[model samples]
Target: MEAIYIDKHYNLVVECKQGSRKACYELYRLYSKAMLNVAFRIVGNIGEAEDVLQEAFLDAFNKLKDFRQETTFGLWLKQIVVNRSINLLRKRRLELIELEGDHLENIPEEESEDEDDVQYQVAVVKEGIKELPDGYRVVLSLYLLEGYDHEEISQILNISENTSRTQFLRAKRKLMEILKRKGPAS
Candidate 1:
């Protein structure tokens, strides 16, 4: 049995496929902000994110006929946005280093901080993410913020699963350092 996705905007999507400009606009209006946020998180620049958002919408509209609707339109658009954002990052020469098999196991683990003991403001956390290297930031955002696991991230970023896991681990440590330096929210 196939799982059916209950999309409330199915009518709008059908209308969009039929070339209804109003329906297309409505779909864009309904999804743009969330899609833009997805793009922004991956691309890490508002201007580039906006550019990606436009390109993603254009791509989605152009490919509307190919949409099978197995998932909600929002999820489809998000995939497009994420792909575009990653492409933009690639064009900017984002590099994800691959780790050797044994290197991961050899790295000494740092003492884990009790995250519940400290409070961080949203803006500060965002700033710390921005401060991370492109590879770390992308992996962290995709894994933590975008909810993709290391295996999915490996496929999405074209790296080994071990590499993805290593990047995520390093990103977490770096983010924690940044947050600690920023201190608890006052």
Candidate 2:
């Protein structure tokens, strides 16, 4: 049996496709902030993320007629935002290195904190993510935040699946270190 996906914004999409400027603006307003967060998480820079968001919206608007609506408009726009963010990173010569067994061992793991001492704040975690290296941040954001699996991440980054796993593991370890240093409530 095929699953049916319902889009709450179907009318808006149809109107936008028919060249309704109000519909286009409404679509952008509904999606831009969430999409901006997605771009910012991947690109690690607000300015770059804003650029990606703008470009993705433009691309989506221009191609609205071609959208088949197999999925929600939000998901389609997210794909464009993520791709644009990655392309911007590529423009900066972002390199994702393949990890061999020996290289993986060289990455230090953070010591586990005491369960009683563990505390988390949204801002603290956000800052920790921002401190991560670009490659690690991208992989972690795609997997943990964006809900992509290792295989999808591998295809997106043009790296091996094993490399994606390694990057995610290292990113987790590094984020732990940053959170630990921030203190119980910080």
| Count: clashes, candidate 2 | 0
Structural RMSD, model 1: 3.6
Write model 1 residue lDDT over 49-115, tens digit each, in one string.
Answer: 9999999999999999999888999999999999899999899998888876634333354442556
User: How many clashes in each structure?
Assistant: 0, 0
Q: Write candidate 2's Cα lDDT for 39-60 as tens digits.
A: 9999999998999999999999
Q: Pick the candidate with the highest TM-score.
A: 1
Looking at model 2, the pairs that clash are: none
Which residue pairs of candidate 1 clash? none
| lDDT (Cα atoms) of all candidates against the true structure | 0.88, 0.89
